[model samples]
Target: MFYFFSLDFSLVVGIFLFFLFIFFFFLFIYFFFFSKLVIMDWEIMSFNGFDIKFTFLFDWVSLSFVSIVLFISTSVIFFSFYYMMGDVFMFRFIFLVFLFVVSMLVVILVPNLIALLLGWDGLGLVSFCLVIYYQNFKSLVSGMITVLANRVGDVMILLSIGWMVSIGGWNYFFFDNFFCCFWVMFCVCLAGMTKSAQFPFCSWLPAAMAAPTPVSALVHSSTLVTAGVHLILRFWLFLSNYSVVVVFLFFVSSVTMFLSGFSALFETDLKKIIALSTLSQLSVMLFAISNGFCLFGLFHLYTHALFKALLFLCAGTIIHCFSHVQDFRSLGFCWSKIPFVMTFMNFSNLALCGFPFLGGFYSKDLVLESFFFSSWSIFFFLFLFFSTVFTVAYSVRLTLYSMFFMEKGFVVDNESDSEFFVVFPIFLLGLGSIFGGSFFFFLFFVDFSEFLLTSFFLKILIFSFFFWGSLLALWLVFMDFSFDKKVFINYFFYYGSSMWNLQFIFSQFFLNFPFFLSFYYLYKLDRGYLELFGGKGILFVFSWLGNFFHYISFKSVLYFFSFLFFFMIFMFI
Candidate 1:
């Protein structure tokens, strides 16, 4: 028995396995505790003689952003479990949600160009996938167009990378590249414009409403769309060199802000209104980034995520309850039936309107302050002011029309009450919109009071204007401003006239001409080649030559080999 025990190895293996289990159990416990107790430090880790640096630096900027993203994503996932309970493609939805979270985390973590591009592309891919997940042909087409348009901007970024490699070598993809990185900075800003859905590319965002509500919330608010603003903030130092690029960004952002806001004013679809509002709000962030108030931009991004996600989730609940009706004009007196949803949606709309003491007030004030200090152009200030007014106008219009106004022919049947998971996120996000900024200031050692005072009376003046604007819009909407066909026509005429002015002419002549010329050259080349070798000329020549070569080579070689073989055989015989 002793000899048998000595020879047996099974017990030794069992013991080893038991020890391994214990080790893994202890390791799991250690990591769980570490994740709870340890704050991620901003540091550089090196491997294979290459250094990768990142800051888990929970500053005012990163902390605010990361907290908002995680909160919104987690809430949306919680809501999805119930909202998508009976869905066939629930797993696919969750997969995209996880992918979005991972992409956003990567966007916030990596500190260099290559890593940033990785995150950027990842977000874009996830967003495009989510947009077309319903498998509708129209939605898929929109997603394809969005992907292709954004890829054009990505190409600029790739070119910028090559330019950086040429100018500063491979090691200069980090923060240090910004010191003299004007060209790369320009390319990156262009990329940001496309990613954030500014100007001509802004159409895709509104068209993306074919996606489910949760996807719209996640894409527009927290993760993918904000990647552009993240890129700008991550490379703020680089952008400072090209002040003209900053101004260009500002102009594009400002124009898109008002354009989308006004477009939202006319839109009746609940989700499209929200989508347009998102474009406008995102433009505000880009505007902040252009003005060098990156922290302010980040602050706005955090709050916007909270409120916008809340609004979208509430919109989802409404859509689900109303048998998929999405038009604000089609909804009437829903505030009484869906009290919780009404209250939360109002909070979100108010926050978006930049009401005092709300999240938007502070961030909007920061943007106004940045504009005042950077360049005191009256046109810029007025554009900001009018955009704010329009933002208020549309927010009130959406809320009032959807909740209070009674349509003559439309009646809503609210069959389902919003579940706990959906209501909980809305309440939480509303609460955050109220206090998140203050908490961020404390966490990051940021002196909000001083920063608030940095612009002195300008901030107060802007706040007053926003306040009055909201009041005026409220009054006008409540007074039931008649929709005059002539006014719309006149407004269209004004915009058309401005568009056809000098800028339009210049764009057509200088910018568009090159594209036309290239197309013409390609056309000429095709025509010339077709005329020179029309029909079957080249094919016939090639065929004739092939037959000649085949006959000459195969027949001649076979006959010569046969004769030589016969002669050898006869000699042998």
Candidate 2:
């Protein structure tokens, strides 16, 4: 009470951001030592065999992930300054971005189940809000789907939490009880899948492109999508023991990778293409985790974040400079017009394709080598190879289509001025995309090596996938093949492009069924039976009783007394 003074919120935020930058930036540097440790613990409450606490683990895993998240988030915020410039609700937008960052940090750092759920929900809630921030019908629909998909994961987590109470609090690290652990593992993996947009849950991700591009850069890259990967990484210890769950995750991850790759190959919107690519990458991470190489999975998450963010930012610039044009067919060659955007876009795409020595090369190459060495079925091995090859194929296919092709006399939209604030962030992430993975590998994999059971032929086989995929992509581009009639040609084309009609299935089961049941209950139960018995039927019975007891007349009283006296005489005799 000695002094009344308050710090402005802006100043407080600036200070917080500055502190995080310095602390984590240094942690990023120092983590090369790989001295993992548990750093902090604080008890929040205790009662009746229930315990809750705030604790954090500082390991190479968390440090690496958190560092990248912080770095990408900062870049996104800077880019938003330009993307969201002159908007009336700019402050609200910025605030929501900050909330997203903080919640994601919670997801990354916490070791306890209860605390993790808080972050998980916060990420979902904030992302849904961001998705619908434009307040348009499309955005609303997209946001609803996104939120509902995430809510499925939230319910699974909640069920796990409820089960946790019986086992004493929300610490799942020491989850020894078999029944509890089994169900928890199953639910947790499903929750992770939904958050990561695996398989049937994949629709909402492309739809979430309705949000501003800056939000897309952050959400798709470092925050929302990666949260699922981080959750699985956190539970890797427990997950390793359950072979059934592992097998399930493996197959699911493989299918997701292939479907997303196939879908991305056919996608047209520039941002949607990047979103689908991000979906494919998430599947790659899950596949790595499922294969018991979680270290590599976490590594890929880090590397993917850098380039994926750059890809989105570059897309944002392209779309922004063209007055928000996203249709691939309408775009013209822009290398001469905006050298920076085109250069960085190609760099990110190259990295995405696992170009030699780039960011994606280290993790993806290692994953491929791992897959080659593992004793998987021919189907999995082939799909894994196809997914990897398709990653390159689509990267090449999309880049060449968008930036290298131009029809003469084509009119183009230009807003190079809007690229001013946007280009800087793209440039920064582009640098990371070029060198971030190699840097992490240098430090983290100081002694990294593997012994695959093969000769020169097998080694060449791995490298040949990339080359053949590029050749295929170039062939398609050169042929100028546009399969506009594919949908009409067969039902397979329609089903594949429409994500195997998963949206219809999800809508019917989760939405229409519930609505139908709600209508039935309201009409038949609430209004019909409940109303008849509990409402009108009770009132009629009371009214009839009142009429029977009505009138205290002398004749009525005498009749009642004579009936009672006759009954008493019959009983006594």
Candidate 3:
């Protein structure tokens, strides 16, 4: 088992993943163009009315997503070779990371609810282990938050499974009861929302930055977080039937996007800022899905995964080179030290802002254009508009603070980017960030000419927000307002930085309340009443009864002897 932890093992896994990516990429093309097929129910056995099968789904969606996952996993594992060097538990770390990837694959390729649970639970369990990899208090707490938030989703999925059992079997794809579909969709939406960190579940996404940078690059960017999006997409047919669910999802996603973007603008912790950015982008995916653009949402998912992974990898390089300084405030004038990483980071940041012709542009622009075409109310329009602007604002803020601004801070003289393991994956993902969007857009939508035929004015309206946000952020960042001195401004900063006190709510209400409730139960029930009445009470009653019986037995025996003697004398007489 230890042998699996070596660098050579990583090389082997990377090569295998690359091969799988190639195979699945072509498979996706074939399925998309030539034929669509699903291979189901490689049966194991049958219970009363339920059949357990290792059901595998192989359609264009699964194929394309699998290809992308394998590609990113390959890059991440290779990057980890250099990123996690000389670690004492390198073996355990590698094993857990691989397990994480496999779990994601299982979630992607299975349609059976029971089979999905296997993968779903695998993802939650393995993620908890990975998040707490550092074995510190902070990581443990973060891991707990991350896992518990996801466990809600797991419970929802389990409920959905039970609900599906009422219809016939665990196969959700073949569910026929329209009434049952609504309940399943509701449970699924809750599950997806939790896994994707929508709205109230949003705190864990930023907290999960406690994991190692490579884990963040993989888990946050593509695998763990996106599992929810993928799950919802699988249930899109059911979800589309319920306009109520779609409307609710739209509002939740919009709030999540706005909140995350707002929070990132004030976040100084570099990785948390990126994590918030990820949350915001995830909200964008959910937004598109909720607006009845499943394919568009999926397109964004693929594009975002590419560039976002690139961003995280670039951020990881920056953190690694600087002796793990993760605060953007302490990382000023970074370009002079690490120009390559800064360049890629800026590329990804621009892509994240949906710069024209970049990877994010293809999907993001379409999602916005489609929304504009819809007849939704003006409030949501502005919510989405400001959210997009906030994305650019934070991207510009991060790029300027880290690369251009001059501030007095510690600088590591030994920073180097010469390693092949590190540079190769970054370069690979960089190229993907540059062109992957257009490539996927072409494949996904051969002719988006209908959406493209909108007026030039409408087209430019979306891109214009990029400039507006960048200029706004630029002015704010470069100006000397002494903004912190003012009470109103200070309060705004505090609210923005704290996710509008959502963190406090999650920590106090969600996390602490459960712990306090459990402790109370332990005292009042387990230790107090249950102990007295359950085990101890039973033992005392048994002991007392035994003593009483032992004493009474001697007296009864003497009485019985005297009675027997009298009876025998009477009989003899």
Model 1, 312-369: lDDT tens digits are 9889888877667897667778777788888888888888887777767667766767
Residues 316-360, candidate 2: write the lDDT tens digits: 877776667887666767776677788888989988988889999
Number of clashes in every candidate structure? 0, 0, 0
The TM-score that candidate 2 achieves is: 0.84
In model 3, the clashing pairs are none
Task: Give lDDT for model 3.
Answer: 0.87
> How far off is residue 20 in model 1, in Å?
27
Error of 1 at 326 (Å): 1.1
RMSD (CA, angstroms), candidate 1 = 11.4
Pairwise lDDT winner, candidates 1 and 3: 3
Task: Encode model 3's per-residue lDDT on 315-406: one tens digit a residue.
Answer: 88888877788887777788778778888888999999999899999989989988976879999999998999999998998898898878
Question: Candidates 1 and 3: which is better by TM-score?
Answer: 3
Segments of candidate 2 deviating more than 4 angstroms? 1-19, 31-34, 45-52, 177-179, 407-420, 449-454, 478-493, 513-573
Error of 1 at 242 (Å): 2.1
Provide the lowest-lDDT 10-residue window in model 2. Answer: 1-10
